[model samples]
Target: MGDVFAAVPGAVVDETGLQHLGNPLAEQRRLAAGTALAPRADRAVIAVPGEDRLTWLDSLSSQALARLQPGVGTELLILDPQGHVEHAASVLDDGETTWLIADRADVEGLYDWLRKMRFRLRVDPRIADEFAVIGGTAGALAGVAPASPAGLPLVWTDPWPDVSPGGWAYAPVDPHPGADRDWSEAIVTRDEEARIADAAARGDLQLAGLAAVDALRVAAWRPRWSADVDERALPHELDWLRTAVHLDKGCYRGQETIAKVHNLGHPPRRLVALQLDGSGSVLPDHGAAVRVGDDEVGAVTSAALHYEEGPIALAIVRRSTPIDAALTVETADGPVAAAQEVVVPPDAGRTANVPRIPRLGRRQASQ
Candidate 1:
């Protein structure tokens, strides 16, 4: 693949191994305006080939896939036995192969799991390291002529900022960030990366770093595997059902827990958007305690300075935390007051419409 940082001055690589241009704020604005594109170096692609591929994956993931349409964008999650998200992927198929855009951190594990699960199925899952992902506003690259070492490229448009089929929206507020989200990623051969980067470097095309992309993601209330998730995190808590889940899909490993939670239970915690008091220069890191008064109620999952929202963050707080609670995030600079905005409301589930049992007193009176 292309090393975008090696050829560009003032480019920095992030913790996730992606090249980021130094000017994040400017980049964020440019991208939202469709004037810039981000190289998704924090991600990798895997290709699943064979006639059995679609059906096989459908049997194992949260999204139904046996009849998936080509070029239609969707996503999948592999949940643990407890229905906690274990892995997630943006999925697209190009007639012959199912392309999976996975978090760089989850690639190996997802590959291993697929390989082990392919007992006798004629499917092959292999890394598409030859392809590098470029993300930007919808249709930004639509006019880019194809010149690739791996034939025609594939594209996966994010369905986030919108509720996909069989998914639910917990963000009750109107005019949510996702309402205008236009993120899309296209995969081109590694050779194309340098050309794209060079063009971006020359200002022939605009360039954005990962920081800008992340800020936009946070503003949209999107949940990502590497940054926003923990061992106990559930899809409902992150409000990820907007894109990464299928409630009525066929049984998978964690189906029981998923069904129970959505049908009769609520997530133990819920996601909130935090507008930080940016008086101090410090930005809270992931895992920074989020407190209501002196009591810890949650922790910051992602934090960034939005080009529009100034300082904003995403935190998973106790479900019982009052929706209007004034919270603070514990930062190295002591504490920064955070105003909460609901992403996943405390009453996120109960969709199964499981019948509520009558209280003992009520039942006795009725009897």
Candidate 2:
């Protein structure tokens, strides 16, 4: 069970005083307002443009970018020579330049890598935090236009509105009315704090704590780098080939390795969903063993008690494990039956007929 919302006179407080509820009525007002907005965390934006921008980027990532249109975005995987995923990002193009938004932790590494690879390319890659991103399901953003919500640049709207199914939009925060009034950002100025507190009292948007956000993401099967990937993971192994890899794309640093595994061999492992049986102890953290009988087949990468699906997890299991079979996930306490819910269908697995870049080298060693 999670912590309860304590009703404290005019204010709402949790057991921990750290979160001082400003006003119950106002919070309730915002909840009733029902304007859905979710924060996009662990993302950094890198802007790139120049005479050689497209070719430079295309030569680096696992996706084909020669055809990426303006006002659209595509997911890409940056890989090491060994084909291990170094980082992943959502790349957006404005026709003139491309912006790469990746996990916050990987931004530095990515920036450094891009800098090193800037040889003779007329592209510039730099971190820009002036833009803030807020998103929500399409239905919630139905009425909002591409214009700035308040005064911030509505730089762009979700081009593939139907891709996420439920839909979502990312907009800057400054122009968003009352968005700056919360203690969410770490570097808010004193003057901004009072203004934001006042805005909070006026019943603007409901602030969803990180816990609620985490639960929502897990339910959506949205993979997170911290929970779902590591240095040992390959782009294909994370079930990102469809979204991250461009099968027909030309040569890149790791293209040979990627094409080899994708077209000619099975990836070492496959990412799958694990539905925990029964109301067990809180799902174990990442790296807990997943066993088929007594033999360990894989480990849990992410786990949570979904609001709709009870206990569920995402794990990278051995490719040999039967897709339709049931397995046991080993928690600290003991083994618990976890039924496999295949997210990346087996047919889409690496063994399938993934288009290859002709005459690539042989497959790399499996993990």
Candidate 3:
């Protein structure tokens, strides 16, 4: 069944485990209209059973999950000791168990970590290889089931638009881009994947690839663990406080850093949207240098060509960078001028409704 779709025109399987079906731009359109799906081979699922599943996870991660009701969708981040994002997962519970869908590269480590942390708890964690992940918009998956033949298909609906309980929004816009990112991922069986592949073979399934999905993600200013995060990534820089981090949550691995920064400091860097020159078709590669004149102020985290908006990218720039600065991204051939759109503004800090204590500078001025 896989071979049948592998032979689809321009079907190239990359290391990311997503097969691009030739026209990514066209795929983007189909995806937006809720007619396309991306078989996400790059994802893996973990199952946690026992009555203590929800509270056990709530005690460890960055989200406030003490009350994550069944069929509800949310996300949590496993932060390093320093509050840096180490692993991220989309979470869902179906009354009996909790499902965690994370990137394949990080899932194994996450599984191991969860096992080690299960001492004296009722949590039993294991890799759910029987399941495959399906990525598409909410409307496209309107009728999708939460369970499949393989097992319980925990559906992780993205909860980015709303300021989840105990979460904060750093995006100051009235209607944030996240409001339109109806992205979702479903856990299904091998048989289901085959069924979709067979449909594609018969010209029935309009499928897209990582390229199309990622481009829209960039356009939506959404942060991805694989592309946007490094060893030093903090949730504040990506404006991820909107969904992933629960500032008031109980102590976890990186909670200290999260508190100190949001209360008294700024993230050393910030996320910016880059509009690459569309004069040529070549898109800048990941890790491309984002420069101000000859000095590299930041590096491109993700780059893609959108369907309606052409040649857009996301880069993490220095917090002190001028908002109106005209920047350039280094491509293989040459440099392309990039205009910076502030995703995380220079002053993005302490977004919660915590009461304010005037800083020393303000007191001194009044004195």
Question: Could you tell me which residue pairs clash in candidate 3?
Answer: 83-254
* Model 3 Cα lDDT, one tens digit per residue, 292-319: 8888999999998889778888999888
Clashing pairs in 2: 151-175, 152-175, 181-196
TM-score of each: 0.92, 0.71, 0.91
Arrange candidates by lDDT, highest first: which order?
1, 3, 2
TM-score of predicted structure 1: 0.92
What is the TM-score (0 to 1) of candidate 3? 0.91
lDDT of each: 0.82, 0.56, 0.81
Leading candidate by TM-score = 1
Q: 2 or 3: which has the higher TM-score?
A: 3
lDDT of 1 at 236: 91
lDDT measured at residue 97 in model 2 versus the true structure, 0 to 100: 67
On a 0 to 100 scale, what is the lDDT of residue 94 in model 3? 81
Number of backbone clashes in candidate 2 = 3
RMSD of 1: 7.8
Poorly placed runs, candidate 3 (over 4 Å): 1-4, 7-10, 143-153, 351-367
Error of 3 at 336 (Å): 0.9
